[model samples]
Target: MPTTQHSPQGHGHAHSLAQGHALDRSEAKDSTENGGEAGNMPNLSTLSLDELKQLDRDPEFFDDFIEEMSVVQHLNEELDSMMNQVENISRENESKGSHLVELKRRLSDDYTALKTLGEKCDQLNKKYLKKSEEYAPQHMRELLQIAASNADADCDRHVEHFLNGKIDVQTFLNTYQSSKKISAERKAKEERLGTQLSALERAGI
Candidate 1:
């Protein structure tokens, strides 16, 4: 009889008929005694003596049985390997999915904060622009008041010269009227700027 020995490369086609078993009893016994292999395989202890005798009478039948058992064992090993791979893939997917969800949540929060900050910036810009616009006309009016005072002083000097007979009445009238005309033009420009400023303020600019 051939010795009952397991090999990593599996059995050859030519197996000893005297050592052939109906079920993988030797392998099962090794498992029970030594915890040699994993999973459930066929055990010859489950077969009747009469069945064993019948299998012993036919070497072909025993050989076929051994072949079938080898095939089943190989298939079980492959199935276990596939199951392990599937489990690993599932764990990796779960971890990645959790990380992706966290990233999406952070991105959403960042977008919301950015939008709020942008709105605040827009509000500040508008406030600064409106104040600048309002101040511009006020500054122009102050400069115009200074210019008008200077012009009035100049006209008063010309009138004094005319009264002292240092200049004629025609020259005096011309100089004074010219100054008044310049003052009128300045007032009209100031009124126009004031109207524009009021319109801008009303429009919330």
Candidate 2:
């Protein structure tokens, strides 16, 4: 029978290769258990070409790397979707804010217009009240009294002229009678107005 033996260097090389494969499998299992977290997975893009080639040569490691890459891609897509939703919400809020501003401005304008209108109405009401007061019963009665006194004075003047012979009897009689009639009518109106005012006062009007 012939004898065969393995060299010491060959034994050491085989042991190192076995250790490298075991380490790679352990890392891959840890990455999978952790749900392929970014920190646990290697960044293949940053790897040198020679390192990538080495990884590609290992079937189990390449498969694990591919799975991790897929998880990263899915995460990136979800993040992009979330960012797009945030942008859309921000745009909607901005539009609502603009509408609110416009509404506020319109309300301010309406308030100012209402205030001006209120002031104008107050001024008109004051003017109307003043005009009404000028034509009140008390003032009208005063005017009527003055008119009656003037008529009486005119009648007296006419009588005097007639006595002085400056006016004829027919003319004096006509003028005096007209003056007396006017005085009587004015006095009657004044008396009637005073009576009505007194009645209103008694009634608390």
Top TM-score hit: 2
Model 2, position 9: C-alpha lDDT score: 98
TM-score of 1: 0.40
Q: List the residue pairs that clash in candidate 1.
A: none
lDDT of 2 by residue, 1-205 (tens): 9899899999999999999999999998987788646565667779889879978798887766766775666787899999999999999999999999999999999999999999999999999999898799999999899999999999999999999999999999999999999999999999999999999999999
Per-prediction TM-score to the true structure, in the order listed:
0.40, 0.53
List runs of model 1 lying over 4 Å from the truth: 1-49, 52-68, 137-205
Error of 2 at 121 (Å): 2.1
Q: How close is candidate 2 to the true structure, as a TM-score?
A: 0.53
Lowest lDDT block of 10, candidate 2: 35-44
